[model samples]
Target: MDCILCGKCLEVCPLLRATGREELGPRAKADLSALLRGDAVALDAEDVARLAGLCLGCRRCREKCPQGVDVPALVAGLRAEHPDFRAWLWKTWLKRARELWPSSGMAAKLIPEKFQPERLAPFLKALSLLRGGPHVRPFVAVEALPDLRGETVLLFSGCTARYVRKEWRRAAEKLLEAMNAGLHKDKFECCGMGLESAGFGPDAARMREKNIRAWRRAGKPRVVTLCVSCHKGLADYADGFEDAAEAGEWAEALTPISALLLDGRYMLTENAPARVGYHRPCHATGNDLDHALLASVLGERLPTPDGRECCGFGGIMQLGAPELCSQVNERCWQSLAGSETVITGCSACAAQLTATAPEGVRVGHWLEMFDL
Candidate 1:
């Protein structure tokens, strides 16, 4: 069946709202999918690639579509048909993040803007985020640990936590140790969402396989993820497992660190920002436990009305259309109002917000709010 073109997706799409381009929205993408499948449009490989690059991979369209159409998945399939240099760059960056990320900020700094081509500009901006953010004082203090009785929990620290934001990993480990939960570390690769969005399907599969094998080798301990995207990515691995029981086990083993803190007690520190805000990740669920926990801890400081803004870090779109990504980030920050500090659960969102935030505005992971 063809897309009804109900326009529901347009209402929630950050790219469309930010750029005011109907063609960039999910409704148009769905229509484009139908046209492509029917051979109604004769788009060359580059044209197809450009069309695919318009998406943010937020999955907001999938949630609002009446037909349950996954527009991001459709776009990813389209992208897979036309591989390009951007895909190769993203694959190399994600796969070799450990070796590349730590020094990326320095590399970005050393290169002059005049020497950098437009295609390499977005990556340079991404590298700047790896350089790190201004130190924001912690606001929440762990008064006590939650009663979590289990085997040694494995930390599924994404690329950001592993390299760029090592502090997030340390904070997570501190929380786990405070709860007396033994911590296990592994050499996990990129969550593959980055590669999958960039149209490198085979590489994405290998990443998923590598992570799953690492989990299995660790004796399938309850996995705790620091970043929201990492949680979604690891949880998504269930679909690839051949055995139904194993799939269920894998799904059950995945846990967001925020979810673990729902029952734990916390107190706002004296240094808490008077106007703190939360930036909801596009990949995050409708009822985000991270926000919920923050609300419980922050009370009036964490306002509910405007915390739902998308950070607009559009995976490969960052390289494909960096200007659009910047526009969306601009709109996201505007929606945040006059927040003194903004916290997020997704590493990509944190990076984007940190890179684009106005002067004097601070951005960091929600984990950083704690004095771990």
Candidate 2:
């Protein structure tokens, strides 16, 4: 591993800004890994462990870096080399919980009933009222489109959205239906983003195979996902596989819901109330097409100054590093400072921002704002 020491990764690193520690940056970590290969570094395991844990794995650096270093993968490799039981426990338990009780009903049972919003800032507390609190609804699978219905187009609803954020699926289905596109529901599983993040690639691969076979059944018209993490996983499905190109072909195509929604052909109603601010999830913003589409959908509702800021949820990073999550959110909060409501396509972003919002700010899904 050669370290070019390009500060590109540091520019978008949420953890670096939160902790004010340069060593935690991707280039620094890459350099340390390079040194460990040549010399017997004296750094203790605890210090090494802290550095690995600090990464949010948002992959923003991967897009910015000219050296083409896979920073998230490097960090995952380091964490696997020096495994931490606590981190493993948290990740494993959460995955198991999601799998076993994969429904919003389970989330209602798991989350504390009398949760104290006071534990967060008053602004966050006020924003929580807009969402009405965590409630579970039944998961409704996306139905295949009627006209020009393709035999393919697998719909992969990852575990989190399958259970906790079912409404997003509803929104996606509505949008796709409007496009006259069909969706195949067979042979799909969770996209394994949680497993990949938790250093359980073998299991993630197994799940990926199951979904691939499902897509193959329909000859893979196109893969559509409501979750940004799942969208990224589908896009990078070919990365390490020997038959990557062939396996990736099984997807035929992969797209987020926003891409379909903002196709320009759709006659989207433009009359909506309240000024909206768009919060770009790290995954969506990192991709050019999805980012642009989401912005276009927001249109004039999008806040002028800093409408493109990240909400800083980063999958399970909010739970893993709460303080860092808060700090990163503070930047987003400031960017969306004067908006009546903040809108985002990602449920994780919505939840995290709502949890940490400052006074009088409201959090909502972009679809909810429009009559779509």
Candidate 3:
């Protein structure tokens, strides 16, 4: 009810701005949520479910809203109340994608796409290739250090890192081991970002419970992840378990590799001097930990380009609305206009940017700057 209805969210919304779909904007979703909460219902359960599927979950809507309305959560409720086929499919098969393709994204093929087989094949192949690319890799893998310092920390190997780009997991491990900290590896499931996006709150909760229990079983030491989405999901769950208002403030609390460095827990003695640019991801926000930590680790080697827009890997949006995803992602690639290598912090961004990167332009993670 606090929404000033200033329409600020519409102006910068990647989906609305790119596709000009006013109905997909936050205001419309909020209105729909209100209707679901009461009477005078215009949309039936099916129509309501369609509207819920039409979001990027980028939180730009809430970020830009003056009222700071929890539109995403509201839409999530509507989605939970209405179980559509697509939601059901995502709730069911997305887990398969995570588990079966532990080293690839072959599961994205399940999404109903509008493209011909030839065109779609290459995109799926490109997604599968997200796990490859030493040319675009930011950090090199180092052997585990022998010395140990602090107690073990839980390293949540997100699906993308586990399957698509194992280097991300390797990088996280290498970096952590350098800090003299032992690792607590578990048979953890997906962090529930995809399930949450699909409105499968119960499914998402189960995954969250598994992770929470993993933490409990592992002694609940400090936790960290290389994947931004996983980090966001885990942190949000922890915060929600504490307070509603703090729920989804995950980026603010989730410990990225950057935070460890800032805390004197990890140290980068030197950096390779390279003329490289960067792609700022949505999940890398909060206290500018990514930017500051990169500067400290990379030194004068970093020359990131301007603009920090979404790479169009908004979980299900890429699968259900590829065209809109492409348009928004085109903007991100464009931002890398004059750079040699584009570095980012999120696995999804790395994958999307790498898939569509221009000739001679490589996309990588910020951790790649380390010599290790």
TM-score of each: 0.93, 0.79, 0.82
Query: lDDT of model 3 at residue 5?
Result: 70
Ranking 1 against 2 by lDDT, winner: 1
RMSD of 3: 4.4
- Candidate 2 lDDT, 179-233, residue by residue in tens: 5666556566777666676566777778777777766667656777766767777
Q: Is candidate 1 or 3 superior in TM-score?
A: 1
Model 3 misplaced regions, further than 4 Å: 36-41, 44-46, 83-85, 103-123, 133-148, 238-254, 262-274, 304-308
Model 2 accuracy (lDDT, Cα): 0.60
In model 1, residue pairs whose N, Cα or C atoms come closer than 3 Å (at least 3 residues apart or on different chains), thus clashing, are none
For candidate 3, the per-residue lDDT at 68 reads 77
Best by lDDT: 1
Question: What are the lDDT scores of the predictions, listed in order?
Answer: 0.80, 0.60, 0.67
Arrange candidates by lDDT, highest first: which order? Answer: 1, 3, 2
The CA-based lDDT of model 1 is what?
0.80
Weakest 10 consecutive residues of candidate 3 by summed lDDT = 264-273
lDDT of 1 by residue, 71-156 (tens): 98889988888777666666777877877788884444434465446755665765676456664568788888786656689988
